[model samples]
Each structure stands twice: as C-alpha cells, then as structure tokens.
Target chain A: MRHIRITAVVIKELIQLKRDPRSLVMIAMIPLIVMLLFGVGYGGGTGKISIAVVNLDKGSLSWTVLDSIMKTPSVYVKAYANSIEEGRELVKDGTVSATVVIPEGFTEELMKGASTQVLVIVDESITTISSTIRNAMLAVTYKFQQELVRSVGGSSVELIYSSVYGPKVTNLEAFTPLVIGIVLQLVPTSLISIAICKEKERGTFEQLIMSPISRYDIIFGKLLAFFIATIADMLITLMVAVWIFDVSVRGPLIDAMVVSTLFLLGSLGLGMLISVLSRNQLQANQAAIFIFIPALLFSGALMPIDMLSPSARILANLTPMYYFVSAFRDIMIKGFGLWQITWEVFALSVYMVLMMVTAPLVLRLRVD
Target chain B: MEYAIEISGLTKKFGDFVAVDNLDLRVRVGEIFGFLGPNGAGKTTTIRMMCGLMRQSKGTIRIYGYSIPEERSELIKITGYMAQRFSLYEDLSVYENMEFFGKLYGLNGEGLHKRIRELLEFLDLEDVKDRLAGRLSGGMKQRLALGVALIHRPKLLVLDEPTAGVDPPIRRAFWEYLRGLNKEGTTILVTTHYMDEAENCDRIGLMNKGRLIAEGTPKELKRRIFGGDLVEVVLQGRIQGDVIKGFLNVGDLKYKDGETVLRLVLKDASKELPSLLKRLDSMGLKVQSAEPINVTLEEVFIELVTKSEARVRGEAY
Candidate 1:
C-alpha cells in the first residue's frame, strides 16, 4: 500500500470528523460521561438501601441493634413497624428491600450470656439489592457480637480477609479496567463502522474503490484514524478515573497504553468487518451494538468469568474484550509487566491480526 | 489508429439477467466519444467494466493498452472516472476534496498544492475553496466533481452523467471545459441521456436493450435515420395531399395553424429545394417560408430506439 494514498484517506476522514461536531463531541465526551455515571453513582456499592425494622422487644438491646443497622452508610431504615406483619407488608410492596424483625425475646437472654437470632425477612425478587441487604445485616450483627463479647470481658476471635492485589480496592477501582474495555469496544467500533457505512450510503465508496488506492490502504487508513480517536478517548477517561475517581494504575503507563492500543485494534477490526457486512449505516450501527453488548457481558467486566457456565466460559474466550479486560486488570490493578501477562497479550494480538486480515477480504468493492 | 479505450465482446450479467451483452467499442485518442442510451441501456455497466471497477463476465477491455482486471492498477493511473452521483466527500472543503483525490493519484508536495490551486481557479471554485462540499450549489458541486476528476491530468476521462441535474448555462459551461480539455489532447468518454449534449461529441454510440444499435457522427446518424434531410415548406393555403405527393420522396404533409406544411426527404437539399420552389410557383401556390429543418438528436434517438424495439418484437414472434 502506498503511504500517500493512505495519508489521503486519513486526512479526508479527519476533515469529515472535524466538520461533524456532534460526533466529535460524542467521541470525546461519552467515555467521561459514562465513567462519571458508573464511578459516582454505582461506585463503592449502591448507596441508601431502604429496609424496614420491627422491634417487638421491650428491652433497650434491640434498639441498640436497630440503631447500629441504621447508622451504617449504605442502609436506610424506612420505618419501625409496630408488628412483624406490617414489616412483611413493607417488604412485599417494595417499600423496602428487606425487613429486620427482632423477636419478643426478653433482654434476660442476652444478659444471661445466651445467644439469640434476629429474624431477617427479605424480598428475593431483586437479587442485587437483597444481597446488599444481607451483607449489611451480617456486618451489623458481627459488630454487635464483638461488642457483646468485649463487654463481658471475653476475647473474641476474628476472621480477616486479604487480597494479593488491591487489598483496599473500592468497587470503583475494581471496575476501572472493565469501564475502559466497554468504552473501547462500544465507542470506536460503532464510530468506525458508521463512518464506513455512511460512505457506502452516500456513494463516495464507489469513488474510493475506483481510485488508484488499494483496498488495504482504505481499510488501514480508516482504522488508523479511528484508532487515534479511541486513544484520545482512553486518555481522557483514564485521567478522570485516576484523578477524579482516585483509581490508580499500579503498572507503567506505557504498558497500559500498549495493551489498550492492541485492544483498540481488535475492536476497530471488528468494526471494519461489520462495516463490510452491513448494507447501510443503520445495519452497521445495529451490528456494532449487537457485538458490543455480548462483548461487555462475557468479558468478565461485570462478573467473574469463572462464575459463568462452562459453555459460556468457552464463548467468553472468543471475545477480544475478555482477554483485554483480564490483561487490563492485571496491568493496571495488579501492576503486572508485559512479560508477566504475555499470554493475555498474545491472545489480544492474535485477535487483532485475525480481524484486521479478514476484514478487507470480506469487504466488497462493488456497491451492489 | 490508436485507441484510448478498446473493448471486445464485453459482457456483464447479474445472475440470469444480462446487463451488457456482446459489446465491442473503441474510443480514439484525443476525441470526445459520447455513449448515449436511455435508462437501463447498460451504459453505466460498460463504463464500469472499462474502469476495472467490475469484473466482466466474458471479454477483454484495454485502457491505453493496459489490460483491465489484471493490470487495473496501471489502467487506473491513466484513467479518471467521475461517477453518476456527486461522489466527493461532502463534509470536506472543496480544496480538501481535490487534494485528497490528487494524492490518491500519487501527487504530493508542492505539485499537489499547485494542481489543486489551478483546478480551483479553473473551475471558479476559488471563492468557495474553504466551503464544505455539501453546502455548495448544484452547479458548483458538479463543477467541483469535474475538477476532482481532472486533478491528475489523466490521459482518459470517463464521465457518467457529469451534468445530470445542472442548469442549462452551467451545463454549457461544463461542455466548454470538456471541449477545451479535448483540444489539449485529452480523450474523453462520456455517458449522457441529454440528446442536445450528445450532439457535441465527435462520435456517438446509441445503445438500447444492452446492445449498440448505431454509431456515427450526429449528421451521419440523422442522414442514416431518414436517408436525407427534412425540408419543411409553409404554404398560405391548403394543398391537396396527392399534389404534394407528386414530388418524389415527399416524407409527410400536414395542415397546422391554418397553413399547410410539407416535409420532403432530399438527398441533397441545396439542389432539390430550388427545383421544388419553382414547381410550387408554377402551381400558383403562395409559399410563406422554405427551409431545411434540422432533425434533433432527440428525434434520432427516439427513432433508433423504437426501430430496435420493433425488430426485437418481430424476432420474438
């Protein structure tokens, strides 16, 4: 491929992108907006979970437990129902996520050094909120048990959990790499595919095909342009993630950028393949979104791939984003070097090569 | 004897439908050749085959002695094709569009800049060089497309409906530019449905139903269609059809607007017209005007297409 021809295509595409301010703004701002939404809104666990409390005990110990649950940052006590029935109604009507009922136990049981259980009724329809409620209750009970043991002059044994990497990582920090993967996959893929399909729709594709430029030049030139755009988006998003959200990249920035560039190549290649397969911009947009959703879901971004079924795990291996998310986490969160994550890097490279090589072959020069 | 574009037995088929069939054509160097046909006449298909944009089903095409589909790269360097639509990047500035195409043709450095500047001035787009192509008027867009096609100074230019929707004055200006280019030894092969525009070509090939029905100069085609020139005579009073028929090879006679008009076919109108006038004077008929009416390209095209359709139907039966 001639460099001049490729340069021409690149320059022309850049000019077009500059003229369309709306798309340019979308490319630059979407990552920041999505990151802010995820980081601030859903970060460090969803805040203000609502639950109902029923205090049937006449003693003050039950009030102490209720106050402890209410003081927790993530839990919100909606009301103190007079009866267990009213608490259950609150949970059933979705007024609250769960109902914490203290049984009619006399304070004498705890005073005599006997253990009593708290009946926690919960709605199981919304799994995420229910799980959060369960964790909150366990935390409050654990604290109360420690205090009870200490007040009686008895030593308590505690189980402590630690992690090899990011021991104190927040939910936002853990989600940074996945957010990068999602942005790279969705934004650049759809943008490049739409750009290509728009050319075909507007009839400029015929002129390009008839020119002296080879097919590789056209595809590569376009891919390079969008790849640069993706890099800019990644930089802006990473800055926001690191400074604003307090997420750190423990590894070298160069390694992170390299892995990210490879991932971008893979995504851009997928976009080109979709562009070649689609007949118009609408079809291209649909195909890009279709691929993006599955990629995000199976990349272990939202959930661990190990939690997936065996067949789903195998399917996850086929997506470039899966390896990208894994490698991104390893490099950015775990501070692993390129040599340490060689297998993931190799997988991403292979995906990129396969997509880039096959895209042009599938591209039809004739409009019909 | 040198041909800029040569094709023999060129054929294209989409599944079972044949778009172009058993076509043979040769465009000479430095001459303007017009490809005339109605819609779906396979003109665009043949042009695309010549440009190597489509692979032919069966046959050979050589542009400037470069075999197409095999040496397409070499052919593309020497040939510039403007599609039927305004195919330039609409979002780019006019100068940017020209520069992009120029670079694709392997032009760069100061040379590319100079060529773009020259084209912008030549096409009267200098005033709007920085304006986006999508914002230009219809005539300006057509002119810019032509400018892009000529940026590389290719030896052969193939234009498909270069002025399809332009106003008349702009269309005439475009033809003038084409004529100027042809004078400077550039070969042009253009496809158009406009009959008046086709009359400007040095030679034209009329096509219908995927076949070339006729090929000649405008005058030659007119003579071939009617076997002579048509002479229209206006008389003050009605004349008997039989008396007008007494003249040899009188084509058609009709009364219109309170005057009797007579059409006659004469191989040599300059010699036969005077004799007919003398005969009319002796017959005591007052003549208002007498002149040889020029048969338009539209008339010739319609006649050729209708005759070909009838022949096909006759063969079918």
Candidate 2:
C-alpha cells in the first residue's frame, strides 16, 4: 500500500473522530467507568456481611466466641435469636447471610476441659457470601480452641500460611489485569467497527472504493487511527488501576505495553472482520457485542480456564481475550518477564494475522 | 471516433432476477451523455459496471480501452464517480474531503492543495470550504460531492443522479459547470430521471425494465416518437376534425384552445407548411396563426415508456 494514500485515510478518519464528540467521550470514559465500578464495587471481599447469632449458652466462654466473630472485619452480627429455630427462620427469610448457633452446655463442656463444637448454619444460595462467612467462623473456632488448650496446660500446635505470588492480593489487585484486557478489547473493537460501518451506512464507502486506494490501505488506516486512540485510553486505564486501585505492575512496563498493543491489534482485527460481514452500523454494533460477550465469558477473566469443561477450554483457547488476560495477569501480577509469555504472544499474533487477512477478503467493495 | 466507454451485451443478475439485461452502450469522448430512466431501470447498475466498481455477470465493458474487472486499477485512475447518494464524508470539512480524495488519486502536497483551492473557487464553494459537509445545505452538499469527484481531474466523470433533489437554479448551474467541463474535453456520463435535464445532453439513452428502449439526441427521440413536426393552427373559427384530416397527409388531428392542431408528417415541413396555409386561406377559414411546435423530451419519454410497456403486455398475452 502507498504511504501517502494510507496517511490521507488516517488523517481523514482522525478528523472525523475528533468531530464526533459522543464517540470520543465514550472511548475515553468507558474504561474509567468500568474500572472504577468494578474496582470499587468488588474490590475488597463484600465489605460487611449481616448474620444472625443464636447465643443459647448465656455464659462467659460463649461470649468470648461471639467477640471473636464480631472482631472479624467482614461479618456483622445483625440479629440475636433465642433458639436455633429462630436463627434458621432468620436465614430462611434472607434477613442475613448466615446464623451462628452456640448450643446449650457449650460453656459447661469447655470449662470441664472437654471438646465442644459451635454449630454454624449458613444460607448456601448466596455462595460467595456464604463461603466467606463459613471461613470466618472456622477461624474464630480455631482461635477459641488454641486459647482453651493454652489455659489447660497442654501444648498448642500452630499453622503458618503464605501466598506464592501475592502475599496481600486484594480483590481489586487480582482483577486489575482483567479490567485492562476488557477495556482494551471491548472499546476499540466496538468503536472501530462502528466507524467503518458508519461509512457504509452514510454511502461514503462507495466513494472510497471508487478511489485508487486499495482495501488494505483503508483497513490499515482505520486500524492505525483506532490503535493510537485506544492505546492512549489503555494508558489512562493503567494509571487509574495502578494509582487509584493500588494495583502494581510487577513486570517490565515495556513488556506490558507491547503485549497490550498486540492484544489491541487482535481486537481491532476482529472489529474489522465484523465490519466486513455486517451490512450497516446497527448490524455491526450488534455483531461486535455478540462477539465481545462470548469472548469475555470464556477469556478466563470471570473464571479460571482449567476449571472450564474440556470443550469450553478449547473454545477459550480460540478467543483472543483469553490469551490477553492470561498474559496480562502473568506480567502484571505474577511478575513474569516477556519470555514467560511467549506462548500467549504467539497465539495473539496468530489471531491478529488471521483476522486482519480475513477481513479484507470478506469486505465487499460493491453493494452486491 | 474514439469512444470513452464501450459496452456490448452487458448483463447483471441477482439470483433469478436480471437487473441489466443484455445492454449495449457507447459514449464518445468529450460528449455529455445523459442516461435517462425511471426507478429500477438498471441505470445505476450499468454505470457501476462501467466504472469497474462492480463486475458484470456477463459480457464486456471497456472504459478508454481498459477492460473492467481486469484493468480495474487502471480504470479507477481515469474515472471519477459520484454515486446516487451524498458520498462525501459528512464529518469532514469540504476542503478536507477534497484533499483526501486528491491524495487517493495520487495527487499530494502543493499540487493537491492547489487543485482543491481551484475547485473550491470554480464551484463557488470557497465560502463554505471550512464547513463540515453534513452541515452544508442540500445544494452545497451536492457541489461538495461534485468537487470531491473532480479532485483528480479524471478523464471521464460518471455521475449518478447528481441533482436528484437540488433546486432548479442549482441544477441549472450544475449543468452549466458540466457543460464547461465537457467543453474542456472531459467526457461525462450522467443518469437522471428528470426529462428536462436530459434535454441538455448532446445525446441520451432511455432505459426501461432493464432494457434500452430508445437512444438518440433530444430532437431525434422526439422525431422517432411523433414521426414528424407538430403544427398548431389558430383558425378564425373552429374547424371539424374530419375536414382537417381530409386535407392532406396529416398524422393526427385534435382540437385545442378552440383551434385546430394538426400533427403532420411531411418529407420537409419548411417546404410544405406554406401550401398548407394557402389551402387553409382558400377554404374561407381565416388562419390566425400557423406554426410548427417543438416537442418536449418529457412527451417523448412518456410516449416511449407507454409504448414499451404496452408491447411487453402484448407479448405476455
């Protein structure tokens, strides 16, 4: 392709985009909005959970157990039930996440130096909150057992815990790479496809095809324009994720930028393919959303890829966002270098090449 | 004679429907050729094929000796096309649109700027050169689209309904510009449904139902439809139709505005009109006026279309 012709198209597209205030605002603000919403909403494990406590044992030892449960940051004792039936009623009514039952004679058994158990009844419908409450209950019971063993003149065994990659990974920090992948893929893909389809809808595509510029020039010109704009968008998102959310980029920044650029190219290529297949802007927008939803679902962003079914794993391998999210997590969270993500880079490059080649071939210059 | 565009037996089909059926056309260099048709007459399809933007289902099209779909790259360089719609980028300024098209045509730097400036001045669009194309009025948008098409100074300009919705004065001005361009050796092939605009063409082809029904100059087409000159006579008193018919080799007779009008087919009208007038004087019917009337292209187009449709119905029956 001739450079001058490509430059002309690029400049024209940029001017058009600059004039369109709605699209510009959407491109710049979507990432910020998505990052802030997801980062702050799910950032720390649902901050405060309400649970019912049934203290049937009106003794000092049971109160100590209640104090331990209350001291945990995530759990809040919302309601006091006199019996286990009342606590179960509170759980059934969805008034709280779970119910803690301290049975009668629990303090008498503990004072006699006999083993006792605290019955924790939880609602399993809200799985995440239920699991979090369960874990907190286990920790509180373990602390009471250690205290009882220490006061009774028996040796206490301690267990130590450590994280392999992140010692203090918060929810926001863990999902930062996912946010980056989603922002890079969704925004550029939708914007670029809509831009090309708008030309087709407005009847300007016929004029472009009639000109001497080749199809490659048009595609590459559009890709270049969106790439620059989306890269700037990615940088802003990166800053927000790092500074505001306290998510660190542990690997080389250049490596992250390069991999992100590759992912952007792949996403833009998918957008071009959609533009080629769709007849108008509405169709293009619909098709982009159609692809984007599936890609996000299977990209290992929502759930781990290994946990998926065998066929689902194969399908996840096909989506470019999967490789992008994996590579981004590896570089950003796992502190891996470029060599560690060679496979993901290769996969994304292949996807980029395939989509870029197929788009122009499928694109029709004539109305037919 | 060098033909700017030559097509023989061009056909385009969408599944079972034939859009352009075995069409043959030839347009000479430096001539304004009007392609007149009603809606769905395959005018746009034929123009697209000629421009090499679309491939013909069958047959051959050669624009300036460059065969379509084979030499499409070469063909696009020499042909400028304005589609039936407003095809310029709406969000770009008028000058930006021109400059972009100029670069696409391989003109750049100072040369591109100069050509854009000259075109803006020539089309009288200098005042709105900085305005977005979407913000321009209908006439201004048409002018800008025309300017973009003319940016590369192509040898052949193919315009599809270039003035479909413009006002009459703007349409006239656009035609004047086309005439100036044709005078400077630029061949133009334009399509329109407006019969009045087709009258300005050096030659025209009327298409209907994917077929070329008629092709000629405006005068030639009128002659083909009416077969002779139309003569209107204002008599001192109204004359009966049978008496007028018995006079001579008149084609059709009708009474209009309380006068006798005769459609006459003669070997030569200038030679025969005077004697016809003398006979009218001798018959004791004073002739207030006798004159040959020029037929409008609109009448010819309607007559030809009605005749073709009748023929098709006759064939079906």
**What TM-score would candidate 2 get against the native?**
0.92
Q: Number of the top candidate by DockQ?
A: 2
Can you list each candidate's DockQ? Answer: 0.62, 0.70
Evaluated against the true structure, the overall lDDT of model 2 is 0.86
Question: How well is each residue in B1-317 modelled by candidate 2, as lDDT tens digits?
Answer: 49998999999998899999999999999899999999899999998888777788998998999989899889888888899999888888898889888988888889889999999999999999999898999989888888888888889999999999999999999999999999999999999999999989999999987899999888778878767666666776567767767756676666777776666765446778898889878888888777778778888988999999999999999
Checking candidate 1 for backbone clashes, the offending pairs are: none
Write model 1 residue lDDT over B192-239, tens digit each, in one string: 999999989999999887899999888888978899878888998788
Model 2 misplaced stretches (Cα beyond 4 Å):
A42-46, A58-60, A110-115, A153-157, B232-248, B252-262, B267-290
Count of clashes, each model: 0, 0
Candidate 1 stretches with Cα past 4 Å from truth are A43-48, A58-76, A106-116, A139-158, B232-247, B252-263, B268-291
* TM-scores for every candidate against the unseen true structure: 0.89, 0.92
Q: For candidate 1, lDDT tens digit of each residue in A1-368?
A: 29998888888777778778877877888998988898887566556888888888888788779879978987899888989899999988889888998888746689888878898998899777788888989899998888778877788887688778846767787788888888888888888887668888899988887778777888999888777667888787788888888888899888988898898888889889899888899999899998888888899877789999999999899878899989988988889989999999999999999989998888766656
